[model samples]
Target: MGMPASPAHDTVDPGEGLMKKQIRTTLILTLDDATMSSFVPLLQKGVQVKAQLGRSMKHLLCEQYGVNPEYLTERIQTIFLDGKVVDNVETTTVKGGAIIALSAAMPGLAGATLRTGGLLAAFRDGLTHEEDLEAVDSHELGMVTVKLFNLLVRELGPVLLEKGVWVTREDAESLVKRWADTPLRAIDHVEMDGLKVSLEELAGLDWSGDSEYLLLRAVG
Candidate 1:
């Protein structure tokens, strides 16, 4: 006699397992208080970001990176591109190896002067970033160095970390060591050269002094 038909849910789809694995691999990291503290310093200094070339700063942040456009326009009062304050993010192109720093509204006259389109913008005219009209070779892949300061570091840092940032091996090692002392444990996995590494092994390595960047992502 033929066996009774199996339940619909009992049938396994071969593609379903692969899809689940992909989803898990690309899951965003969750940043709790302790995790934020451990990574704030690194975020403030700067982290390498991979983005498309030939996009404006506004486009890169709001569209490419999924940052809220309203937040960019309202909350992010200060923006620096390549060490100079940027007044027009729309016109400012994001080239390879560029540095973009963001900060919330600052206090005092200095803050007022540094802010884009502020009344005191004239005071810092020399320091304002001007868009380069010269043509540049565009590529499918581009890298930008992004720095977050003050409240932005706490607010947007986690998102960038989840998206993935290029960090130095030495810096990564230092971060792991610092966390070793903390009571909170947040690192889900650590990989170097595409191989997963244990926390103990990562902390023990003597990383090269030269600039060696690694894509670091924190998942909890």
Candidate 2:
């Protein structure tokens, strides 16, 4: 293409454009043999939770709040190694004794999105623009908690099934309950009609029955 109409052209910033367009992010995760094996089931559980929550979150945000759920601007950011964002996606690998940090953007309504409640909360009044975003931040962080919880749950499943890690759902529950306070895994499990579930399950759910569901919740 040739510049024609105007003699002077506007300056462009490629880095700014790239940053705006990028939607997905990743991090290298390393788990020890014990940790890796222990967390698989839990990871699966977290993925399920994410599948569930993604729907409600996206719907409420888009339909009600007028936010584009699929906007690349609302991306989850992840950190690998020692609390650092992974620089490359193609070469990153998850192994034993690994640490991965991840985050996702909430778009223009960051404060409100962060404040919105999880699945159970929807039963009450759903997400409200007036709600405090700090609560949403808490709920989003809960995904990681469920990820860790389900990881241990999955890891223990095999051992309990094959050899035995002496790990049970209760054990995972205890760890999660404790995490409810700290900053790392601090999200309360939602209980509906006596059926209790985690934030991860709520985040990565698929109520639509469609293929290629959103992955942020699952990946979180």
Candidate 3:
């Protein structure tokens, strides 16, 4: 008897692969009370803010963004600058294009060790971020990306979104596509370049892939 045919090789469908890739690039951010609960867990995207780079992180937060100094010290328990945990938020310089992620207290050993000035902070000394003292010319209008995780999302996300955040058109388009199908009754309307558009129209437009950025705000 002929040998049994070898098992078929697993192959990814082209259309399915494209769809998955698109999904990966898409981001959905929400500000509505009903959606905030669901969106908090899912909001891992960045918000861009124009800033004078080479300023201390604390200055950016407390002075520029109007984040209460006491709240920054007491409420925001964890800080990460470009992936590594940061301890001295006041001294750490925020450069243009840098990503700063903020979070409240987290559970477990890793969280404890990584938290700024936590009892276990010594454990993460090798992985912590250290700032350079050398000064650099600050840009008049430079973009810095900020990410809010966990409680930070609930606490700070709406304020920043309402104040307005800069996002690339490509990213905005991707966001529109991701939320197109969801029953987003919370979204008052969609705006592109200050013109109101329906969700379907927003998703259908071919975004200019240039350096133009959109001022995104979530209205109640």
Which candidate leads the pack in TM-score?
1
The sequence of per-residue lDDT tens digits that candidate 3 reaches over residues 107-210 is 99988898887888778857788778685646456888888887788778666665567777766676677667787666544444433445665566666544
Write down the TM-score of every candidate.
Answer: 0.78, 0.21, 0.74
Best model per lDDT: 1
lDDT of 1: 0.72
Q: lDDT per residue, candidate 2, 135-199, as tens digits?
A: 22122211211222322234222222221122233334333344344344322223211233443
Question: Model 3, residue 119: displacement in angstroms?
Answer: 2.8
Q: What TM-score should be assigned to candidate 1? A: 0.78
Residue-wise lDDT of candidate 1 within 20-98, one digit each (tens)? 2211121122334567578888999999989988778888899888888889989899999888999888888888889
lDDT of 3: 0.67
Candidate 3 — which pairs collide? none
Off by over 4 Å in 3: 1-31, 35-43, 136-139, 168-170
**Weakest ten-residue segment in model 3 by summed lDDT:** 1-10
Query: TM-score of model 3 relative to the true fold?
Result: 0.74
